[model samples]
Target: MYQYSEFDRQFVRLRAEQFRDQLERWQAGQLSEEQFLPLRLQNGWYVQRYAPMLRIAVPYGEISSAQLRVLAHIAREYDHPDAALLAHAQATQDELQASQPGLTLAAPPLRYGYGHFTTRTNVQYNWIALTKAADVMDLLASVGMHGIQTSGNAIRNITCEALAGIAPDEIVDTRPFAEITRQWSTLHPEFAFLPRKFKIAFNGAAEDRAATGWYDVGLQARRNSAGEVGFTVKVGGGMGRTPIVGSVVREFLPAAELLNYLEAVVRVYNRYGRRDNKWKARIKILVKAEGQKYIDAVEAEYAAIVAQDGAPHTITAAELARVQAGFVVPALSPAGIPSEVSITAKPYQRWLKQNVRPHRLPGLSVVTLSFKRPGFAPGDADAATLDALAELADTFSAGEARLTHEQNLALPWVHASDLPALYEHAQALGLVQPNIGLLTDMIACPGGDFCSLANARAIPIAAALTEMYQDIDEVTDLGPIDLHISGCINSCGHHHSGHIGILGVDKDGKEWYQVTLGGADGSALSGPAMPGKVVGPSFSAAEVPDVVEAILDTYRAQRSSAAEHFIDTLRRVGHEPFKQAANGARHAATERRSHARQAEAATA
Candidate 1:
């Protein structure tokens, strides 16, 4: 919803030109890959597998319909026609060579992909694939968007809840603060190269949607006893190899000095954070090793520099004002929303019950489009689906959309009356799935697909489990199951917090998964739900769902009626029963395999 000024436009244009020149030189071989690596990365270009993938930054998941149209245009025109050749086609590479004459067109063989993420929607383009994603940046500069500071050891996309403006319990609007941090951190000279990547998130609501406790720095809006605006600061939290639920380093910080406090924190890390080991260099490690008391001491020491003995006056009020202006809330409709709608009729009831979040404004809601659907690869959508979403955003809502960190799209500030019509449109697009908070709605990493770090494919595993739970009644009865999958031990899919957690591991090229139980949301800080016994070494794809069903069945039998949740049941009965159930499933499968082998040997 924010418009760009002439300066903003010019800045993007200049950056685009810089990247275009760098790309040209690189293609000409004047700039070698070694020299061009940093340059290309700065421009959000990565030399992924078959082609060069360009990641376009969609800051904090907010984008206007106009900017999306720019993206569609880029995708259509620049992509190599031959690069995206469909699977199981008879056109061999030789045949294509014979037909096209003077072209070296590459085919991805069910492997080439153009996917998006919540953390800066980088428009990843395939290298040697017909499309030159730098072309997208050139066009993007004309509008307000650019692929700047998306990667590298820079301050990553400063995020807040997508429903920042609309969430009913918000103490104050957090979107503006997030936007301010983005502007401040964008290519800041002091922070261009840090000890590790920095992540910051904010939550203004009573219910923390930003995963506030999981960031390097988190801000929760609150007011003091005197009713003055302030924030509750949590620090040193991160997930990746070390999962730490951040502690209250500063306890409480006044809103007026929020930026100042943030500066102090960043300054501390940039100065003292470890740079020797890439894996152990995160600020979280620093926070963990040194203790919170040390961190607080450093913060206080640096915080005094704000407006004290002069530190450029520490981000002048005018600078913050300019950044805040960019995040101005839309003029919401004053007309009342229909609260008396019949919830018992049609699918609107399910949607209202699940997807809709209460807005600060009366009768309005922020609608989250859950990409975690039953039997689909988590966060995988084709070009047509992207265009469909863009079109849907245009027709319904305010032609504004937010990409969520949970790999979903959000159409915030939807008036209550238009819910049903919008629901119909989404259904036509196959976007009308009713498994938002259910077991089928899952979070999984892109394991063994694009990432070289993964041990197995979380996409297929997630899809298989969702397919297994096809019965709606059974799924409903399971009750608020949060199943998470991590490709490795790093916990990118947040397996630690899942009610039923699946961790994929490599047992000498054979795919094996670990299961964990009784994990729940730990924002106020939750406890670790240690893993149960290893589920499988010989588990087939088809049987994974059966294993999950057994776990659910175990929960149901032990639970007090249907009132208790899977987490609650697990908490009560402990992991021994679930472990036994999983072991039983594995044993049955192993017995079948042994019997088959014995029969073959006897016949011989």
Candidate 2:
């Protein structure tokens, strides 16, 4: 974890103070809602369905235990809605359920006082009041955290592989580069409000764990035959109404010119990207529409920047070294490594196999605590859980933890000898679920429950599927499956990349779900980065669980062998059988609905 310097601490504190002034003026009627909108958004505050949502940026997914505790404090003290607001929201939800009887499973009452981890490695609070926003910001500043550039049409959080520095096959540690980019992009006057929100990701390892292909700017670190480090820069990738894999704009960009090249890329996009239409504003659309022309324009811009502007943003070796020094590995006692563990419990063995991962260091390991369990939305952690996680990090990982792109917390420096005790502690805290890549370990957005833009509620659908697959053996038997859900076309849940993607759609003012099959996130398991194909018409929320089960059943029946994964089978057999199975489940659900109606009519 990067420690905050005095200058950095002062800068954050000053920013918080400025926000407090802005918030006070807005409350005093000195600033209109129109005027305050951009200001508040710049500070990472958004007015969601029922309340304000705050997004706290976790740069490159790195977080310290102290920062974690501050986040917990914010969740506990500020993430609360008034009783009337809660009741009204609940009533509205109930009315929606009543209007569409049998279309959805019974969902538990809505709760607050939690933080949500996003696929972008940010933390979000759904119920924080705008009045208390400054206080939360101040608290975050105390620990070198903030919500800067988390929202608006500016460059958002810069993300890297969760195992950035510690991956066994890492070619270069991306954290320092990611951090440098973050510092450069933060409040950059030239590209503050671009055509739309821009995202950048880095992948240093041979494997694409960061899903770099799905970002606006994807940087894959590589070394040339001459032993010089650089990046294979991919541009114009995004997922929304349009999901396009990024194209390689530069085969090899010198590491020193990362910012200079990025400046050129965003400069071209900013000048030509669609501003009239929000839907087509992303750099992807511009790049897609222009193709090679866009690449040429960026190249020209880069040449001009170097020739005319003196390449002002070039990263010097000294600057790079300064940033790199902040990422030193924590001291670990060599005695922590034992030849072998003697634990024989099945649960312990399962957790060790599922949640634990190899580290570059000999005696250390990486452990991911699952947040996709039942009774909570994926990536959600309550205040108590957040505090407990901080404690766990301090105790086991030298006060360091990283938020993963998959909406989970990972301790990257856990000692191998502490695995058993750590597993027992995490299990006691309900954080040790041995389903890391399993079907139930799904990615989902807050959906209609919290997001005003959502067409349907994602939580209930996630809950339905989670409840159906509670049997660990059944889940493990199904093998590694990426099940992702989103409440709308925003693709916040990264549904477009899921092996089995569920997207909530609006049909005649009712909630419906469209299932897509054979999507891949460019992982070793998923061969390439490609969007999933829709199977058929959207199904009701109630039918989603059955549809999923049908898809899984189809995979099980069509698989060449027990060891074959679902994706492999889907690729081999194609989507025809799976599509038919999903539609069959929908028809069965319809028949059941019709029979229930008839039975009710006869009774009446």
| Residue-level error in angstroms, candidate 2, position 547 | 0.5
Tell me each candidate's RMSD, in Å, in order.
Answer: 6.2, 1.7
Clashes of 2: 0
- Model 2 stretches astray by more than 4 angstroms: 333-342
Model 2's TM-score against the true structure: 0.98
* Segments of candidate 1 deviating more than 4 angstroms: 74-114, 119-131, 307-325, 328-346, 523-543, 595-604
TM-score of model 1 vs. true structure: 0.86
Question: Best TM-score goes to which candidate?
Answer: 2
Clashes (backbone N, CA, C under 3 Å), per candidate, total 16, 0
Q: Give the alpha carbon lDDT tens digit for every residue of 159-274 in model 2.
A: 99999999899999999999899989999998898999999999998889899899999999999999898999999999999999999999999999999999999999999999
